[model samples]
Target: MSEGFEKCHNEYTLFTKTSKEGKILIVNLYVDDLIFTDNDEFMFLEFKNSMVRELDMNDMGRMRYFLGVEVLQRYDGIYISKIKYALEIL
Candidate 1:
């Protein structure tokens, strides 16, 4: 992943990328699931395509839930929660 992103002009940070255009892209890899997000849609698609070319990955569309966290996208902004996880613990 690091090498692939570097080829796309992205700075690596353990698990994040700051594009040359100053857009932030984050990727969290679990056992077999991967979740990612970016500020720019065009840049995001570009990166996604690059990943697809370099690696065998399946695009899961928009992220609705990841690692027990529920993701909510609204007109105003994005909201994330661990309500399901919390309930399980309680």
Candidate 2:
């Protein structure tokens, strides 16, 4: 393994809850970054607390930018659009 991977550490918390009794959900995490979706809000908070204790985390209060993608959330859903990203190619 590369030296970087050897020192890899978990640095984020994520929780997902479903309104129904049982549902399937997927969560993806990379280093200090995480992404997930669910109808349950409490599940997200519970996951956050567990992550904080283990990783000494800081909740940024919602994601503004992720992996060069800008996120704008509305009551309907999340909108991810890249601004000025196309110009950088030139």
Candidate 3:
């Protein structure tokens, strides 16, 4: 990790960094899966490039579903739903 990224005190698998402009980038790791999001587009690309350079990871692109939750990202905002999970249980 670079660019002053800091590990969370409460969670070892979580890392975060805040730019001087107050933009935040967060990354969480679970086993071999890594999830990350950033408010700054340039910062996001930088982190992605850094990770790709350092690890054998592939870009899965934007997340649609994770842990049974469906994610819908739109220009207005992001929306999350468990309708998919609920349908599976029924």
> What local distance difference test score does each model get?
0.73, 0.58, 0.93
Candidate 1 stretches greater than 4 Å from native: 1-14, 82-90
lDDT preference between candidates 2 and 3, better one: 3
Better of 1 and 2 by TM-score: 1
For residues 5-61, what per-residue lDDT tens digits would candidate 2 score against the true structure? Answer: 122146334333343566433355677665655455665666557667778677777
Ranking by lDDT: 3, 1, 2
Candidate 3 local lDDT, 1-90, one digit each (tens): 567989999999999999999999999998889999989999999989998999999999999998999999888898999998999999
Shift of residue 52 alpha carbon in model 3, Å: 0.7
**Model 1 lDDT per residue over 3-89, tens place:** 334323353333666777788776666676666777888867877898899889988777787778899988789999999889999
Residue pairs with clashing backbones, model 3: none
| Worst lDDT 10-window in candidate 2 | 1-10
| Of 1 and 2, the candidate ranking higher by lDDT | 1
CA shift of 78, model 2, Å: 0.8
Choose the strongest candidate by TM-score: 3
- Cα deviation at 28, candidate 2, in Å, is 1.9
- The TM-score-based order of candidates, best leading, equals 3, 1, 2
